[model samples]
Target: MAFTLSIPRKRISASPGQIVTALIIALFLAVFLLIPTGTVIYTAFTEKGTGALTAINFIDFFNTELFRRSFFNSVYVAGMSVVWATVIALPLAVLTTRFDFRGSMIIQTLGFIPLIMPPFVGAVAMQLLFGRNGTVNLLLNDWFGFRIPFMEGLNGVIFVQSLHYFPFILINLSASLRNIDRSMEEAAQNLGSSGFRLFRRIVFPLAMPGYLAGASLVFVKVFDDLATPLLLNVKDMLAPQAYLRVTSVGLTDPMGYVIAVILIVVSIFAMWLSAVAMRGKDYSTVQRGGGGLTKRKLTKRESLVAYATVGFILLLVLSPHIGLLLLSFATVWSYSPLPDGYTVAHYTRVFGESSLYIKNTLIYVSLAGLIDVIVGSAIAYLVLRTKLIGRRWLDWAATSALAIPGVVLGIGYLRTFYNIPLPDGTPLATLWVMLVLALAIRRLPYALRACYAALQQVSISLEEAAENLGATKQRTIRRIVLPLMTGGLLAGFVTSFATAAVELSATLMLIQSNSDAPIAYGLYVFMQSPAGRGPGAALGVIAVILVGLCTFLSHYVIERRQKTLGAAK
Candidate 1:
């Protein structure tokens, strides 16, 4: 018996309400995201005094030795970070997915720890633990008679970024591995393929999409990062050079805009390369009545080696958090493997003196998260439920924020709003709320995807039934749609809030005064001087806790919701 189940495909013009809703979102993107980004691109290509289109800026960029070096250095650092991140992520992904490994769940969960802390927050801690005169080198000199330059120059940035971002690969690759059809593997085995040859020939090729997705992300993130390089005191990178040129030489300098344009180009290039690699290649292998790859059992020796390997990688990745905690409590920690003494004074000082930073961060991030969810939910609804004209453009515009570097967005906001004034004669750009808007814009894509996924899981039949019962679109969404989407909206908010709390690049440019600064900006300021390192470490701990809690909350909500949905079914 053949069962042909056909679903109707139809496109209807949007209702007036949907058109209005889309227009509102379009306006928001145009003003905040599109225009500012366009301004930066325009500034980069135009002649400074004449406002005419010219290629002189780029020609001069290539001609200058320092600028040329910065460009190549950025590329090299980003590329190396991807390589090292893969090295760290690939093994864990395979071990957990391919074998019946003990503590597999624990290892996967711990990988999220590095992401909660910003790369630059860990930069100083890494230096203390790995620098030439630092603890590791001191111990190595005493014991092994030689030291590795783990925290030297550009190596430091690469090390910090790879450790911080490998989870992207681990997560995506693991999901891909879990979805691979076992039938293909069994067929490959029947054909005499086994071991590394089996993995290379059959398994890895199927997972290439996932690997490239993660690797591209790592490359783009490292390339766009500003604070990590600056904190490491490696100033010859493109992002740092852009920041320095704008702040030190003043925004009127053409070099900053030029570098920002180049950053955008390289980012787009990396994504394009990943896409081109996966082009015209079908990776869909899961078939009916077939399951994912079968797990293999490891022998005692293999288990021991696997545990040992996983333990070493975890220690290396978690070192920053460990070092930060020690530094926060330490009275003095230098030229030693551990702190000399510990105290609670750093936390005391943070609460008493720098409490405003925390408060501001909470307020700003909350508002940003709220904005993201509202806007994201609306976009998702419009796209999925309505046949609104140009609805896809809203999705494209929002997701475009991902390609933009934080430093570039900061520069864009400054240029676009610097001269505009409020009722009190203050420049509109100087307002604290602008920082919130930037955060919202920077994180909208994440929230949008979450909401989109949530909305997709909702049956259109439910909404249709409500409409048939005489309910309005707005009323149906408010009563029927929103309640069903609570889980996803909450997840989206948590994600936006967690990541936004640690953002520094955009905040750096948007912050007009110390009073308005968030924790990330405050951390950057405190870490600049030796005397403030303890308090800075304390704030960093607070940030880690804040992001960690949000992450845990997201997971709990998602799991609880899933259980609830299952029970209802």
Candidate 2:
């Protein structure tokens, strides 16, 4: 009667494919991410001459007045940019999602235009419009005998970065606003809460998660940005300092490694702060019927103000594109309210001379996009569908790339792979394949998040039904899951490709010959020379068009898919 019952042990297992997929992901992250990052960190701490551990590098970085100024300047710019971006974004989010108004969609579309154009590409145009002798300053001097120094030093950097990155906050906040349950707002109103009070207490708090996510991203991006600050001659920033130190002082410079370490540390710390802020917050809505926050029709005065406000903001945001277009075609644009003359010669010159850059961009970006989709899909499946151990770590490893500044990654690649030779006897850093790999690694997180979200919307029963019918897990995924996730996959691929095409910092370092440079580097080079500005602007226009087209196409695909699903239901 006292005999213990025999118990069977349950085994946790993953299929061979899942195991293989996990292994591939692990290896990919380890080689491209972990190894390079670890190498950078290791180099940062070691003495260059003796190869011994030392704190001298950090001490030097901290003690240098220039480095200290750069650090504080970066922090100030990042902090101010977040505040300005939030100010611009929050109102737009409220106007668009909370109030029904004419041209709301148009406002949203214009908001996204800034994100499409890379900050550096827009910096030159911004300078032309906002510089001391440029159009706006000239106009102010002529009309009012007064001028604004909007494009002066770090001020210019912050202005350009805020305009460029505000879309992050806008998009995230708008989505969060749309998802908020109407009942919460109604309940607050019923309890005498109204207007800003309601928003501050209920709506804004609920949307805090999304706002923080976007804000942290903006902070990281502005903090680590290299090209914009460099283009604006704001070289005292952390990223530019890192780049200058490495390039000017050579790879043996410990100060360069020190700056790189600081960049990584600050970026990771910002991201961690964002996550910590959202932890244990119950922002979830109880709505299960697919209803969201209710929108109100704006009154006549409110509608007029809303339209005017949106129009003014759109004009400011779109000024860089306008300046770029004018600059591209201008025969002589200096110190003038408008171009002295216009022609298509710049476009022709870009196409005729920099055609290789364009072609290389297409090849590398497409390959990178493909790589992103495949890897993203595998990681998503492993993390979401399989019970594979340590799968979540894969997600974290891939995403950690976001916290890594491109300059840091580029230096890592150089130091880690400089000696490795390719089959053609050239160093791996010189190979175009390295560019592809860098772009892929840089952009994988975006694709992975998109694919993971798409997979989460899919039900487990579909795979179970397939398996119940004797289909292998691989076959089930191929037949059912892949088809279902096509929209997300294509969206992710387009996003990855678009963003990669405009990548500069990593591309700047890894590109070996002029023949191998992408359009971003081409633009950077063109902007460096006064005579090359027109052609560079022309190239910038082309880049913007390519990204805009891809973005619209992705939206179309997602919408069409949703319609198809709805029709079937």
Best by TM-score: 1
Query: For candidate 1, lDDT tens digit of each residue in 254-327?
Result: 88999999999999999999999999998887685337788999999999999999999999999999989999
What is candidate 2's lDDT per residue for 67-87, written digit by digit as tens? 999999999999999998998
Full-model lDDT for every candidate: 0.93, 0.90
Listed per candidate, the RMSD to the true structure in angstroms reads 4.1, 2.5
Where's the lowest-lDDT run of ten residues in candidate 2? 8-17
Off by over 4 Å in 2: 1-12, 181-202, 279-281, 284-296, 423-425, 456-480
Worst 10 residues of 1 by lDDT: 284-293
